[model samples]
Target: MSQRIFHHPVLGSMEERTALQFQFNGAVYTAYEGETIAGALLAAGVRTLRVHEETGAPRGIYCNIGHCYECRVHVDGIPTVRACMTLVTEGMCVTAGSVLPTPLKKGGHAK
Candidate 1:
């Protein structure tokens, strides 16, 4: 039940690669070598990579070429890592981004 494109009409079959293990939000998942984090997650049926910083809305891969920044996630304690651009490696830990807290004004009102 993987979402990988095994056979393409133009590109033919996908290349064989070594399988690797990675963790996303505390759960382990399998990914092939040379695959990007966003690709692996999508293959594992994970759509929502993170949430909107202010609205708390679910966010997934949009403009997956690394230009949209919607697929950003935390990797190995590093913040704002683009999942679409980062390659998946064995033992890599990935966490979904969360909504940021609202700023408060001088009188304790949200800004």
Candidate 2:
């Protein structure tokens, strides 16, 4: 789905935002200045964020309120950041796993 909010019955038309750039999985993408990392990724059509540390199952945003740790990702070399809670900034590096070596590839790549 397109990330642009276009129009909403309750929220109405989307407001203009200052566009910013960030890197996800080594690729640069556009994002709004105030949007969350998860929101930007989701808007960019990224459904999965990372693999389970124990089971290796694909994981994405679950609670979206920061209570659940399911949306954890590496941000600027910091591992296990809650993507849903953290806001996006220009040039932020978002990766899909912890700092330690894992079976699955980093940045949403499959094992």
Candidate 3:
């Protein structure tokens, strides 16, 4: 039996179609143009997003609201972003990691 696919609110509520192609684990995933990486993954029913920092334990979307910082991912060569707070872009690359973040500003914002 074939199953049905589900889309998220932001993607489903759009006035027009906005399908964008991206790769995850060498496989293609289709998400709306404005959806975030984690949102896409979550909508796809993907749990256990990444690993633990030191204990190497399994980790995933702890705070679907992006407060726990457990869903950090490397997007397009940049690290330290809350996947729950970022929007997906076409041709964007994403990587998963579980290292304790350093106390430094990556983009060199004004002090």
lDDT of 1 by residue, 7-100 (tens): 9999999888899999999999999999999999999899999999878899999999989999989999999999999999999999998988
Superior candidate under lDDT, 2 versus 3: 2
Q: Per-residue lDDT of 1-111 in model 2, one digit per residue for the tens?
A: 456676899999768888989998898888887899998898989988988775678899899999989999999999889999999998899999733456665467674
Worst 10 residues of 1 by lDDT: 102-111
Candidate 1 lDDT at 80 equals 98
Show the colliding residue pairs in model 1: none
Indicate the residue-level lDDT of 88 in model 1: 98
Point to the candidate with the largest lDDT. Answer: 1
**Superposed model 3: Cα runs more than 4 Å off:** 1-14, 98-111
For model 3, residues 1-111, the per-residue Cα lDDT tens digits are 112245556657334657877765455666787777787877777766667765668777877788999888777778777888888877777777756764556656546
How do these models rank on lDDT, best leading?
A: 1, 2, 3
Task: Compute the lDDT of residue 58 as modeled in candidate 2.
Answer: 89
lDDT of 3 at 87: 84
User: Model 1: what TM-score?
Assistant: 0.89
Which one is best on TM-score? 1
The global C-alpha lDDT for each of the candidates, from Candidate 1 onward, is: 0.93, 0.86, 0.71
Tell me which of candidates 1 and 3 scores higher on lDDT.
1
**Superposing every Cα of model 1 onto the true structure, what RMSD results?**
2.7
Poorest 10 consecutive residues of model 3 by lDDT? 1-10
Model 2 regions more than 4 Å off:
98-111
